[model samples]
Target: MASSDDAPRVFQPLPGRTVDRSAAYHALLRELLSLVGAEAPADDEPRWQDRARLAVRKAVKARTVQGPVPEEWFEPMMRATVHEPDPSFVGHLVVPAVAAWGLRPVLLALLDHLDNGTPADVAGVARAWYHTGGAPEAEHEASRDLYRRYQHTALRRFVTLDDLDARRCLLPGLRLQHRSFPPDMHELVDQAVHLARTSDDDYLRHRVEIQTRLT
Candidate 1:
């Protein structure tokens, strides 16, 4: 005969305020108690393959909402199994530090633009890619080496395939040593050179020089 409203208040707040619960809350509370009771102490090296597989599945889902490029990669490279729960089970390890990299599209767009010499267009794509990729910290830089290779391949393909007419931009040498620069510093130097000469602005030239030194 006693429903939740008919039952006495179990919790007291301030002197003036009291709390009451319904049958659903009580049922949920009972379930929570049962869950706590069901928990057991876990081993330090307990089987986490399933957990890891689930985590990678979650990561793949996160990647899919980005766009086609990543989705293509995800469908093939994103599979997981209980025996190999870690994402790096297939190849390179996604370390804690690099795990927060959402820069794949930026790098891809940048390389794409460099090949096409449409810096403004490339910059816009880079921004969009980053937006879709989410905040840089939220993204994992899983395959850096693979990413660089993809960029290089894309650049080469663009150069070989794309039309280059009515464009006055000078083509930077494909080889890094032609500029006699370190591999990591090469792209910045090249972009700076392009922006400086193309803009014909003394300030931009100076800025490029400054960035080149920093890079």
Candidate 2:
């Protein structure tokens, strides 16, 4: 019988080949997203609730693997579906963007697990990525907000004038003045602050500053 030591590694790092790893990571993410029926259509609107249900199903099945799947892998999808009344942002433009953002780290962690042939510590993987400058800091919250609003307006169904007003009030700059930031951005800023506090690296500190400034 093959011992644990004899088990093949799920992922092997190629020497001096960052692009190879990135390409592989994206491929695996697409595969997983497809597995959960989350592939977006190029010419049609996506069904966000369907995608969320599929993600929950996949995450549940993944638990049968040897170790824990990272919470980040599945939490956002589940959370997005937890809203009262409609649970789904079926036509909400923000849903897809937020889903993609939340899924990136989850996909990387999943890839690491597959490559390692073992359960992976996603937080450790995230720390490594941040330390290596793999994570891109958002340069401008205003730009992101504007883009999200534009997308929402363009894609949303049954959007009312009240909804537009609500969106305007939720813009980052406006919310900052009211001391009310979006939950996701608040969490990200908190994480960056925590990371900066724990690490002495100058670059990490600068990255944290850039992220926090946007928040």
Compared with the true structure, all predictions reach lDDT values of: 0.30, 0.30
Model 1 lDDT per residue over 1-215, tens place: 11211111121111110112223323332332233232222324354333333344445444435533233332122111101112122112122102323345434434454445333232222222222222243232443443344335433432343222101111221222214333765564465356445554344344434434531
lDDT of 2 by residue, 83-127 (tens): 111212211322232334443443333233323321112111211
Best by TM-score: 1
lDDT of 1 at 169: 16
Clashes by residue pair, model 2: 10-115, 11-115
Listed per candidate, the RMSD to the true structure in angstroms reads 23.6, 20.6
Q: Which regions of candidate 1 deviate over 4 angstroms?
A: 1-120, 129-138, 146-199
Deviation (Å) of 59 in candidate 1:
22
- What lDDT does candidate 2 reach at residue 178? 15
